[model samples]
Target: MTPFLTGLGASLGLIVAIGAQNAFVLRQGIKREGVLPVVLVCLASDAILIFAGVAGIGALIQSAPALLVVIRWVGAAFLVTYAAFAAKRALRPGILEAATAPRGMTAWTAVLTAAGITWLNPHVYLDTLVLLGSLANAQGSPGKWLFGIGAATGSALWFPLIGFGARGLRGFFARPASWRILDGCVAVLMLGLAVVLAAEA
Candidate 1:
């Protein structure tokens, strides 16, 4: 139980960061664009990554320097691209205030986008799965399950709070300026994360 708590704390430490997926999740929730599906995808993706981590794949993944490099470059590319898109949206006349308008995407699209964003981000695996897995391995035995559970729980805990919190702010942030602010923040965040990731990788 002590080890489990340690693992849980570690998981929360890794997750409680500013990142693209969280940003997107928050935006979707605020905009009410298939919030449930977005949150579910975020949770499911976290579960898969955490499971992989607990299974001791992190060490092997670490050993594969080439793969990590590829992921770093790919992630950077995606981040830059996403940042550009977010910046573009920020400039658009109605992107932000569109929340009161009809949703531009279907439910499936929302699900896929959320899942893909979570899955594609290199930091997600590096922080949650690999780091959490290695920590659990140190504890051994049933501790692995606990660590995975902890990480999964972190995601489960975070996504709902973010999603719901966004919804709660919808009424106040329903202005066009709000969308501009959100998207601008998204762009800055993605670019910053990408720079940090590439520097570390």
Candidate 2:
């Protein structure tokens, strides 16, 4: 039970931060477009990663610094591209009203984007595979599995909350200015993350 609680607290602490993934999910939630699929993809991805970590894959990953380097470059490029798109949207903000709102992403596109955002980030690997893996293993035996379950549970709870919970903000986002501010913040965050990734050792 202690291991479970520790896992839950650690998982939430890492994921609750405002990142590209969270921003994307929030946007999809508010727009009421492909929310379920997006949320499921993120949740499933996190669960897989968490379990894989507990399964001892983290040691293999640690041995391959080159793999992380490749991922870092790719992730940085992806983030920069996303940041540019966000900046473009910020330049021409639109209201969230159905009639005037821009065309939303299809379920397939949203799912793919969600997967990319979840899988491409080097930070995700570090957090789930390396850090959480170490933490879970330190708990030993059955406690490790329990910790993994608890971590996965945190992801399960969080994605739905942000994805479905964002609907409440639809009213506020109906204002173009609000959308502009949101997009602007997303752009900055994405760019900042890209810079950090590129500069990281």
Candidate 3:
């Protein structure tokens, strides 16, 4: 119970931050399109990552600096590409305004975008593979799995809550400017992360 609770709190603290994954999920929720699929992808991805961490994959990652470097480059490139897209959207928010935008995103498009945002970000690896893994392993063998399960539970609970919760703010997003602001924030976030990753690489 202690390990589980500790994992839960740590995972929630890390996930509650506004990152590319959370931002993408929030946008999908606001659009009320493919929210379920997006949430499911994030939840499943987190579960896998967390379990991998508990299973000692982090040690493998640590032993291979070259692999981390490769991931860093790829992740930075992906983030830059997404940031450019966000910048373009921010420049023309009217196209996505709730009142004017095409009837939300296609299911496939939304799913793909969500997947890219979740998987292509190196920070996800750092948090889940390194940080969480180290912390879980610290609990010793018996408690590590419990801690990982607790972390997985946190992911399971967070995505649904954030995805559904954003829907409640639909009325506020009726304006085109709201979308612009959102995209602008996303652009900055992505670009900043990209720069940081590139520097590290």
Which runs in model 2 stand beyond 4 Å of their true positions? 93-102
Leading candidate by TM-score: 2
lDDT of 3 at 105: 77
| Model 1 regions lying over 4 Å from their true place | 94-100
| lDDT of the candidates, in the order given | 0.80, 0.89, 0.88
RMSD of 3: 1.7
Deviation in Å, model 1, residue 52 alpha carbon? 1.3
> Once superposed on the true structure, which residue ranges of model 3 sit more than 4 Å away at CA?
97-102
Residue-level error in angstroms, candidate 3, position 170: 0.7
Which residue pairs collide in model 2, if any?
none
Question: Residue 190 lDDT in model 3?
Answer: 91
The residue-level lDDT of candidate 1 at 17 comes to 76
Cα shift from native, residue 28, model 1 (Å): 0.6
- Write one digit per residue (lDDT tens) for candidate 2, span 17-112: 999999999999988889999999998999999988988888899999999999999999999998887788878534223322556578899899
- The candidates, ranked best first by TM-score, are 2, 3, 1
What is the C-alpha local distance difference test score of candidate 3? 0.88
Instruction: Output the worst ten-in-a-row residue range by lDDT, candidate 2.
Output: 92-101
